[model samples]
Target chain A: MKHYREPSIEAAETGKPSRKGLVFLAGLTLLFSSCRLDMHDQPKYESYEASEFFADGQASRIPPEGTIPQGGLRQGELLYTGKMDGGDSELFPFPITQDTLVRGQDRYNIYCSPCHDKVGTGRGIIVRRGMKQPPSFHIARLREAPPGYFFDVMTNGFGAMFSYSSRVQPRDRWAIAAYIRALQLSQNASYGDVSEEDLEKLEEAATE
Target chain B: MAQLFHPNINILIRILVGVVVVLAAGLGLAYYQGYYSVYFSQVNVFREQPVMFSHKHHVNGLGIDCRYCHTSVEVSSSAGIPPTHTCMGCHSQVWTEAPILEPVRESYRTGTPLQWVRVHDLPDFVYFNHSIHVKKGVGCTTCHGQVDQMPLMMQVNTLFMGWCLECHRNPEDYVRPREEVFSVSWVPPSNQKELGRRLVEEYQIKSRTNCSSCHR
Candidate 1:
């Protein structure tokens, strides 16, 4: 009120009305402006929104059959199905690298570790919560199983576990199979399996 | 006419004017606060979804990964919402008889999608890509909060322009190791300043405050 000098103190003396009420009214109007949300939410569909116009009631749609998205041509029978010449191939379709193993480890932790456990043991958090326990990767049968067998099981699913093909990509699936090999070695290996250089480091650590 | 009024009334009028001014100022403050409150912004307010999926039970209790259901978070713009089949993946085997999961089972059987109410819906004009944020080492919990702790999904950040600008302007304050992006209980270490700065540099995150960066 002090900031606004009377629009006319002389007018006040002459009995003219003040404009101060208009300023207060404008402030009130501005306050209500925040409530308007015409732009906050628009007429367009957001992801996974139910569509009234669509017959399926979904804003997203399933692609027609035989439609292949980019990089989705299911070529390389060994890579896609873990089989070649009508049998589960015992070799990886692509050469495995350190980066592939790292990526596999990451994906495995996210998609498989829930049921297979971080150590690839039968006990995971889900098993404790009542889901069926998966077989350990350390078992004799699984240890003797080819890398292709592991990839096949993940793509098609085993007895109790669901197929992860839709969740994990093909490259990552191969990568997880590779990581499972490394994990098996980690669990079943002895001191003799270590390299001389690494064994020396292990001995140093053991002494410490 | 009797001096138009009692001279003492002038003091009374002045006091009333002061009261009116103070009252108006208080009202303005309340209006501003109210505009940003949970009622208006929906921050920290949980909306009831159809099935009432609990992230706490799935994430913390069962150790399910965020990517277990939202599989495309790293590869696509929008984080994929799991179809009912994803829910049935486990529920069909474990919680097969639970009344709480009847809607999920029904959706799976009937092939009708469950209407899940979106929790972190941004304005239509703003373009947000989950993949870019994930690739740039912005942890899921950075914007979404610690979802493992939420029994019901809710908005944690205000999702306002000012709130986004905080990270966009200085990503070093929020960036984490790419490996830790999906981790539920990952806390910023004491050396977050150093680590985040390195990650921001390593991830090549640009300080994108241009209107075109978000608004198309």
Candidate 2:
């Protein structure tokens, strides 16, 4: 049987184990340790990853036309279109609860506050920058505008404002309209509009 | 073996062994640190993009909401990149002929999508969702760093598994109020530990340290 150190010259000559083979093996281990990315970056494409396969460097291709995504088939005429019988409906498709109003406020701040301002006065940062100034919700014309009119304006573009159909969902558009009604009420409120309990507090403050 | 070791060889051998041990330890430390350094981890590195979009200008200067451009961030896995139309929405009226905005104009004109280079690319095997993180009270700035301060977007953390495990094991260290999630300059209050603890319980943040929590 051949000895364990059969391959080394020094082992063959002197019978003493040589360190050369061990050193070479250690070097090989070190060389190979730093180089395996086989599982790190796979061949699959993420949402907006670049692709060499297509002429347009995009891995995410637009679905072929007539291909509706799940939930794309919109139901409810008033809900999706904000219209009923070929005209904007005055009533909300869903009831406007306090929660819906709060959701509307949150969405409004994110989407509309840039141009409409927090108080719905139309003098927002975007307007101050250069864009055309939108009419205030407190104006008499807008004050009397039905909820569906605001919904239609948001669903389709109004004068200088672009349609927010892409940025905001249909339900959110109605919620925003509800909030606009809330805003118009807040802005145009008079002494007669105040409740008896709230009026007592206002009366106390007014007297002070 | 006449004098295999001189009488003083004992001290020489001890000193030589000490030196070897110190050298080995030094090499080991260098290897460990080099392996995890930002250079290797892809941290704080800036990559060139087709358009030099600045978060500072859009976020801090203009005070535009993060949702304005990243519309699907709250609902989708991806914080949606603004299409050319979204850009043209403002630029059409704001800076009609600025040289810097020429690429935006061209893309809008030609209907070609502008290719944006991704900054926070995780390893393909790890699954991350923007909606889940944002919903669970992880502020955008928590993982994204002070994005409002970045002129050109750059990766802030190492994005290593070990770093992720630190948060996964204890979420109270980073959780915040849900309402303040999109706030660009949110400073953790002095009582963050207590506030964060309450938020973790309220938000139902599971200390998801299992391999599949992110690996899947």
Candidate 3:
């Protein structure tokens, strides 16, 4: 056949590849470029993204009034509000079990330890870092303050401290109050505060 | 024609061309590789903050917990920065006259915030929840690296999509006990892979690879 010949000298000088290489490269490029990016800029409304469907033109719909949210029902005054007859109450809504105390400790370390400190000394790491040092729980005034008073401060903002109702639930707030009471008791404890059996253990440890 | 006949000269030309090609290829590969390497990708780039607060000093030296300064870590998406009062609580007593603390004092006096530059910044599109991660048994060190060791905060991980996917697809490899979430020096136990799997089941963590999980 007339055209069945080796590549010409001109082809070598031009540096043209054989037909197979060009076709292969074209196929590879097409394969890569064909991937659909439809998922990236999706037709979706983000949280609070404005919408035309709602009359307010806001995507986030406000819950209807009198709507008791799931797990949002606050039936008891002492449990939720920390108040009875518009004043702080002394009694706990739930029994203060050892498990409750442990939960209180965990919650306290996470939330209150920054400001009130591990010992409720008002000299937490944040206080050392530079925030206003609150009154120590060991102070006679705070030591005598009822548990509900602390709960009031947490539920409703007290002075410079903001309300922790958002971060802490009502039950957890009571737990924190209980823990704070324990802390106050710890720092202000006298020999009379210890039981006879615990006193013996303490004496033994001291003698050792 | 005479120049072409010189065999040594021809050999020298070939060797020079070969060296150029090898050098070019080496440089190109290095440019590609180094661009993505953890060492070079802003890994140790320390941004200057308004206050020269050192995590090394506050965390390691003073034994401060990560939550002390980043207060809202357990409740909010962003770990809240400590307010100006938090700084003055100590400076009001200790470093009252130190010139290094001038800006902090000024912010306190003005009732204005010291605008601390964020170091570990994520893109606007990505939705990362600190509370979910922290509550799900991911420790502070798991994502933030050894921040107590960092004198000035710097981005350590690349925080690229692949890096995120690597963990998201296999959370059992990294999950720890909830109690150890705050422990900066916490090491995975000898039976970690086994424990982690149990934790994955207990925590009910479905390591989702769907785009909407993080993107939305």
lDDT of 1 by residue, B90-207 (tens): 7878879999889999998999988888888888889999999999998899999989989999999999999999999989888889888898788899998899889878888899
- lDDT by residue (A75-159, candidate 2, tens digit) is 7789988887787788999998999999999889888988899999999888898888899999999987878898999888887
Cα misplacement distance, residue B22 of candidate 3 (Å): 4.2
Strongest candidate by lDDT: 1
Q: Of the pair 1 and 2, which is ahead by DockQ?
A: 2
Q: What lDDT tens digits, residue by residue, belong to model 3 across residues B89-114?
A: 45666568889899999988986566
> Residue A128: error of model 2 in Å?
0.8
- Which structure among the candidates has the greatest DockQ? 2
Task: Flag the better candidate by lDDT, 2 or 3.
Answer: 2
What DockQ do you compute for every candidate structure? Answer: 0.57, 0.60, 0.11
Alpha-carbon lDDT, every model: 0.88, 0.87, 0.80
Candidate 2 colliding pairs: none
Q: Tens digit of lDDT per residue, candidate 3, span A1-208?
A: 6777777676688799767768998867755542544553345564434567877665557688999989778888899888877778877888998878888898888778877888888987767766677899888888878778989998886766767776678898999889888887788789999999999999999999
Q: Output candidate 2 Cα RMSD.
A: 5.3
| Model 2: residue B110 alpha-carbon error in angstroms | 1.3
The candidate with the higher lDDT, 1 or 2, is 1
